[model samples]
Target: MNRLRAVVTEIEGEQNLHIITFDCAGSSLKMMGLDLPKGLHLNSHVILGIKPSHVAIAKHLSGELSYSNQLQATIASIENGKLLSNILLHVKESDVQSFITLSSSKRMNLQVGEQVTLLIKASELFVLEVLDA
Candidate 1:
């Protein structure tokens, strides 16, 4: 699991389902969820969590994409396995990791220091923990 410390910036939508936005590493992150935990309000500090497998990489991405979170980052390092590839990315002051297939990594020709876009869906995000402001 990937974890990020963030603060809730905004919240929208009806009961049971909401579009929650957060300020993380100077970037705005959005998450779609069925329910907001009790006492979770705007400005509340929380821990954002996502699975490495859920992260998608895009090269020279253009136009509109359905994914709510698109982070601009650079490949920091890569650990290629027999079937899976572990990618480390540097985004602002944070390091994000992604697990992708070796074939996809080769198809993209990803290299260290190469610019790439990280795509993450709102639904893939989860509130790992809420911290005191």
Candidate 2:
């Protein structure tokens, strides 16, 4: 899992469903979930987690997307295997890894230091740990 340190900025929704927004090094990220952790509230410091395979990469992307979290990143390194490719990205100060098919990696021609956008669904992100009350 890729973990990022963030602070809760806002929260919306009713009852069991909620859409929580966070700020990670000035980047806005959102996560949707059915349950909220105890003592979680505005300004809470948290560690967010997501799986590598859940991260999507886009080069020269345009227009809007349905994904709730979109982060600007640069390719740090890539390891291509026969069936899958692992891409390491530098997002601000954090290093996030993404796993994509080897074919997709070649099709995008992703290289080290290339600029790309990382897309992640809100439902895929979760609060891995709460650092503060």
Candidate 3:
């Protein structure tokens, strides 16, 4: 099962970019102005609990093939050149009918309401900083 989890409470956003606020229920992730990836609709995402082993992959968006743990979350929002995603998210407070984005590809093996467990690492979670090119 996957480990990333999120519930969107308010998707104050538009196509390709938006502010997605969620609750992890495991920790306090209150870092403001998070940088998410692009191509994210409003509801297309997977909250992930990154493990220490996957920390490098999560931060770099690259994973090893042996683990077969290819988790890629939709860009909740982007700043500078970095991408961001919310885990254990909340998106119920605001009434919306946004289209959900399936996984990055057809082979993601994910379904709506499907339970997943993320291999979380303490180092994976951190405050984002925009890198100027």
lDDT, candidates in the order shown:
0.93, 0.96, 0.31
Name the candidate, 1 or 3, with the larger lDDT value.
1
Q: Between the candidate structures 2 and 3, which one is better when assessed by TM-score? A: 2
Write model 2 residue lDDT over 1-133, tens digit each, in one string: 9999999999998989999999999999999999897778999999999999999999999998899899999999999999999999999989999999999999999999999999999999999999986
lDDT of 3 by residue, 20-90 (tens): 54444433222122345343334433343333323212223334533322233332321221222122311
Which parts of model 3 are misplaced by more than 4 Å? 26-46, 49-133
Clashes of each: 0, 0, 34
Angstrom error of the Cα, residue 22, model 3: value is: 1.2
Question: Cα miss at 13, model 1 (Å)?
Answer: 2.8
| Model 2 clashing residue pairs (backbone) | none
Candidate 1 C-alpha lDDT tens digits along 1-133: 8898899999998978999999998999999999996678999999899899999999989999989899999999999999999999988877889999999999999999999999999999989988973
Clashing pairs in 1: none
* TM-score of every model versus the real structure: 0.95, 0.98, 0.23
- Model 2, which residues run further than 4 Å from truth? none
